[model samples]
Target: MSGTGFWTPVFDIEKRGDGSILMRQNDPLTDHRPTLADALDHWAETAPDRPFLARRAPGGGDWRRISYGAARAAARAMGASLLTLGLGPDRPLLILSENSLEHALLGLACTCVGIPFAPVSPAYSLVSKDHRKLREIARTLRPGAVNADDPEAFAPALAALAARGRHVISNEDGPGRIGLETLRGGDPAGAEEARAGVGPETIVKYLFTSGSTGAPKAVINTHSMICANQAMVRDCYRFVAERPPVVLDWAPWNHTAGGNKVFYLVMTNGGTFYIDDGRPVSGRFDETLRNLREIACTWYFNVPLGYDLLVEALEGEPALAEMFFRDLGMMFYAGAGMSQITWDRLRAVARRTAGREVLLATGLGATETAPFALACTEVQERAGNVGVPARGLTLKLVPQGGKLEARLKGPTITPGYKGDPAKTAEAFDEEGFYKLGDALRPADPEDFTKGFFFDGRMAENFKLTSGTWVPVGAVRAALVDAMGGLVRDAVIVGENAPELGALLILSEAGAAMAPEAREAALAERLAAAARAATGSASRVRRALVLTEPPSFERGEVTEKGSLNQRQMRGNNAEAIMTLYDGGPGVLTF
Candidate 1:
């Protein structure tokens, strides 16, 4: 309602009088193509010279670009080669690499020919000391071909696999490796045949879940699910088609946020994507800052930690801030909830720089929902407002254990998890609605149209020894905001204990302070926050600063930079005990 002409907010909400609400977009869903490859072909013919993707050369040389026509031609050649390699649904392509122009092109090539591909997180292969998870994933996928950017980087992982007959491809040739140029050197004879076989039900890719509770399961992504989700996105944010979206992103393609949402959002709209080399972490964020100074993104997205760092940079650098918001229409945060403090600072910085307010929004979705189910387009200053259900999606809120559990049934929802029929059977309800396991409450209790605030994950919320249920998501966001810039994230502990506790990940500001000063400052902030608390659940009694970062291999932190609350608590049981044991370095309220 308070935004510019780029987008007009619209939603319809109906109350059933039984504490349940029905919400949908006012705009009707547009008829999208059956597959993503069709959209690429359309753009290639209509705007052959428009830039589709761009990335800096290795070691930060010149910017490399691939136009729509060039990308289409390369994809066709790659698809033809894959067909000859006998890669299809049963024997698919497995990609293990970071985000690159080649990664994007190869991913598109797989889709063009209906060749199912799974871009597994490079962490499983590159970071872990033992490639157990990667082996399990490759075994489950039974891939006919494996691809990586650098064969030397993934040499150990590649060696662990049973690679007698599998085709190995990389940018540069190595032992038993076929170069990328050679792979795509084949003619486009089989390209048309592959594209003609694709339909709405054709399998496009396999997106793996975080596996916070267990082994990661591959969620089947169909062409219909992805295409329909983009239609809903276009209906919600109308400015995308008006001008080609320019996006700078670093989120890994293994996750749906970057791989499906941002990647396809650009492709489906005939937009340009710049692969961001900088991440939101402390050491890597400088690349993001440098990119923001050069490219004025039409739409921007980052996790909460990234936003916090950007806010600090924007407060100091006026030139960078101006370039960042020059043509920006909306700023979005996901992979986790954004704190109110970060949200306020971002809006203030944008207003100061752009001389007009920009929409700061967040949405609710999961890997199973093609990663887009609800989006908030309303103008609000606070965080935690995940907007109404997307167009063409049916959202059913059921009351469970004193919370509203969200479920989805639509074309965008995944059919089920791959290679896990038992888990799939347990995933849906009797009505065939996929249980999302997240809880939500109405943003405005009296007005159902206002949207909903994320409560907490059903499995993450725990009961104290006093029989009080603690909403981890709400409490963690409140505590982090209350602590100001001291804490980046937290894991709320005290399951079956008397009171709540937290393991805090220090922010950049907090980490910059001297050891003694940091401890004293944290104590002061903890006391202030505890004084302002109103309930036992909101009141964090004891806190411990995490000395070590969460490990990706341990499942404590997901590749998307989201903390796995349950996994974190379970992995650090000794730390929790030490805090409760009245140990040193533990601040008590």
Candidate 2:
């Protein structure tokens, strides 16, 4: 049944002093429009000279910016470049690159025309050694142009495809490859009119899922879906004409959160987008710190691990904290839930620096729905409540068998994956709604308007020997949240074991300082957290903090730096047994 056309319920979202529900209002925007093309057209006509992208080199000197006019011109030129290569709407562009100004330009260009561009993980280009998955992707979509962010290896990766000969373009050119700069130099771009009459329903980009657990699927996105979501997100954040926010972000554009959501949010609001070349891991994070030292940004977004490291560094230097908080409006976070310890530390530091609590908000989203479906916006808190759905989004949690499953219907939802109608057909329900596959029971289901926490994926959740179904994602998140800096991530034991156990990996920094002593201290803290855990269902009764790194040559760990859980367990079966049976470092009673 069609529930309602549009409804925003104001239910009790917060808890009162007496632990009762407190009324929190949620009113959807009255002027919700659903198209990215219209938003850009409006912004271009209204404020053409406003800086849309502000970026700098690694050393953090002066910022380079591109205005609305320049952005539009570059997009058209790139679109012209796509057509010059004999590409069309039928065949999508395969972009394998990192987050950069050029990547953003090409993405916007694809939207200008009806040509769909799919940006795959750079791991597929440089990291993934197997090449099986990358080869499979090439087989599915015989890409016309492969734009490798890297100049050296990217061209070769694209050339690995059989029919991909003579159509590969590299942003960099050294030995023998076509350069992106070379393409933009020869043409005045007379193909601007060819891109006219493009509408919201046009397929803009195809984003592949990370597939940490299994095979990746290309999530198709359209202009209408992203633009509509962008409108609601921009309005909710109050990014409007009068006062524009300055953003300092370094998240990979391959992910929809950074590419579609934040990118469009900045463009739609006419704000300045300062692109950071730094990454969360490696020595690049130092570049982020150096960048923060120079410019005063209104908004900053990063992952929880990145935030923790930055905060640790900020505690030592007050001058750095001064530069950070000088004109900062809010510090946004995403990717993973902020642990309670991390959240508390952030809140304390924010209060110390800002003289009040500066909000650290996050959201729940996927690559499928323009990377933003739910967020914590209206009110500020450290807890994990991803707030209500956006203006046009309609969420329904249907109980199938015994678990509550979440389904969504809106313009922001993707039409389907590129050239895979069978998989796409399996993704939706009978009512034509996109099946999210994950379950979502209201935080307090009695008062449904309070919003919902993401229950575990239906496929991932498995039943214990006692016949009790375990929500893996929620339990994993909760345990990791409790462990904080001591454990980087975990492998939930007790799949067939008698009791719950964990294979813990210490944070690199935490492990570096007096490794043995730190492990001892962490063992005690972990024991305490386990003892304090709510129930036996998820509690990690014993844990083993892994000291040695998983070998890359053995394929136990991927080049993307993620552990293959099943492989890891098999590789370290003795340690898993030790942790399971409470053998050596079992500090908990």
Specify the highest-TM-score model's number: 1
The lDDT per prediction is 0.87, 0.68
lDDT of 2 at 460: 61
| TM-scores of the candidates in the order shown | 0.97, 0.87
The collision pairs in model 1 are none
Candidate 2: residue pairs that collide = 200-224
lDDT of 1 at 362: 90
- Model 2 regions more than 4 Å off: 1-38, 58-61, 162-166, 172-176, 185-189, 239-242, 378-382, 400-403, 513-516, 547-578, 581-589
Can you write out model 2's per-residue Cα lDDT over 320-438, one digit (the tens) per residue?
A: 88888877766778766567787787777778987965657766767777767776553344456666666667665567535777666677788887668898899888877777787
Regions of model 1 farther than 4 Å from truth: 5-21, 26-28
For residues 185-225, what per-residue lDDT tens digits would candidate 1 score against the true structure? 96887789888998999999998886656678999999999
Top candidate when judged by lDDT against the true structure: 1
How many angstroms is residue 159 displaced in model 1 relative to the true structure, after the best TM-score fit?
Answer: 1.6
Error of 2 at 69 (Å): 1.6
Full-model lDDT, candidate 2: 0.68
